[model samples]
Target: MTLDQFEARAREFLESRCSRRGPVATEWGSGEERLALFHETTDEQERAEAEAALAWQRERWAAGFGWITGPVEHGGAGLSAEHDRRYREIEAEFDVPDMAPLRIGLGTVSHALLAAGTPEQIATHAVPLHRGEAVACQLFSEPEAGSDLAGVRTRGVRDGDTWRVDGQKVWTSNATFADIGLALIRTDPDAPKHRGLSMFLVPMNTPGIEVRPLRQMTGGASFCEVFLSDVRLDDALRLGEPGSGWKVATSALAGERRAVGDRSHEMNARAMALLATLAQRTGRADDPAVRDAWVSLHSRLQIARFQQQRMQATDERTLTGAERAIDKVLLAANYKLIGDLAAELLGPAFVADTGEWGTFNWNRWLMGSMGYRIAGGTEEILKTMLAERVLGLPREPQEMKR
Candidate 1:
């Protein structure tokens, strides 16, 4: 079938599924969404609710929508990227499932692994990842190596056919529940920091791997700290050459950075609808200031979609590293702008538990806005990248190399 036909059929299938009396869950079946689902429930009830939502996702995977862009040899549909995007558009309208959690695992990590992994490596894990039988988390960030990712001190050493890893990763999303984790660490500390690194797929359940969830401003554990204490992995699990972690991570991060541009488009329609409700409820619809802000918000939302289309029309590999950095900066700024518009329209109801309509649900956006500033490279770092790389400015010499 044509791509258009596939999307149409996918939507029809989703509509039928959404119409059924499926399990009622939060907005996205995530920590942020859990507050909405079990607004007032015991821990046991919330756990059960989360499990039910995950079960729904498994059902969708079985139906073929879950593995749309995955390698067909690995139990995926082996469809083109456009097909997956169209299917996501259809799937988003209904409550069939929320695959945001899988974006890093499947979209970024798995795709990168498939690109860089050995044939035996692909044979062992690619299909399981596509099938949702495995969940993966990125182990990239560290206390001293947040924006300067190459400065990672996490160390790995060769031990016969296996490598031992010891490192600390911070701000790792989904690590607490992830089945497998893709981590970058220093395999040869004596070499230049960037050249000494290697990437490995470490299981979260492995001995000496500790995942501690970090609470956000909104009181959710959306991020975690991963500690690897002499964790070991067979050479078979390595993604690329011994010291090619930076290259591998760059590719994976490029995919991630590319994916960010689509975030605003995902929830903009729903957010706009909610904004109108808030405006009317607060009697701000008549205010000229509010109207102007609303107009600006709508324009930004459209611009985000347009940029996405432009990026899609070209081969992503043709994009410069700077271009990817620009995309990350734009995505974060657009989300913050949207969050600002919401705060203006919704007021303090966004933070306080006022029990007012359209207010309580905004904590997710408020919290997520700040996170956008930090995650995927902080705003400051992205701006520096734009200046140094894109603008062709002189680089500062470092004296600490001794």
Candidate 2:
């Protein structure tokens, strides 16, 4: 079917299936409602919410909506970039099921498998991911290797038919609940740091794998720490050539950075609206400083949206590593600007647990606003990347390896 035809059908399907008691049927509308419900849910309501969300995704996957940019052979619709963008637009208006935890696996590793895995591996794993039957998480970052990923000490020793893994990974978001992990480990310790690694698809249920949720300042379990001890994986589960794992890992990270840029556009819009609400409620909408801040934030948000749209529009996808740094910088700045404005506008109300509409919530944004910059790559790393790579500046001295 044509892209338009598919989008129309998807919208109709969403309207028909979404709970009427919640928000609109569009993706964002539905997502906002679902997020509110998700955040406010009690332990008893969590399962019911999760099941409802899962069922919604199942329906979309069956109808060819969940995997638009995916390979045609792997149960995705195999549509063009425009088709994917259009689908996301239609999806934003309704409160639909969420799969944020699954995105890194399906969008990144599934594609990586198509690029580097044996055909048998793709056939065995890709379709189940699209159907939301399994979830995947990354096992790259370690206690020692945050931004300096090549410094990871995770080891995978060769066994007769399987490899034995032992390592620890930190900031492993969603690892505790994931079905599998895309682990990168040192298969040849004597080789150069970046050259000795190998990638493996390791089942989370393996006997030696342990997952512990790491709570954030926001009181959320969005990140975790993982311990792998003598976990075994068949050679067939390896991705790419044994010593060429950096290529796979780099490809996955590049895709992740680009995806972050795209998603930030929608997120910025919501942030602006929330700020606007605060401005109007506090009678700050007419203040000169508040107006200037709002305008500045909106301008940056628009530029981010345009850049993201341009990146998606190009078939070759020209968002290079440095351009991604630019996106990250803008996202960080926008978050801080919006948060500051919201906090300022709320004034005395911001510090109190007023139980009012937007009072206590200010603290969440105030604390979490800078998380994106620090989480993905630190601001210093991004600035260095932009200076040395994008602007052709001289390289700085290498720091001591921790």
Error of 2 at 63 (Å): 1.9
RMSD of each: 4.5, 3.8
* Tens digit per residue, CA lDDT, model 1, 70-121: 6667667777777877776666556654455566776678767877987677
Superposed by TM-score, candidate 1 places the C-alpha of residue 218 at a distance from the truth, in angstroms, of 0.9
Task: Write model 2 residue lDDT over 158-263, tens digit each, in one string.
Answer: 9998999988998876565677778888999999889999988888899988888776666765677898888888998899999888888877776667666666
Error (Å) of candidate 1 at residue 122 is 1.5
TM-score of each: 0.83, 0.87
Query: What residue pairs are clashing in model 1?
Result: none
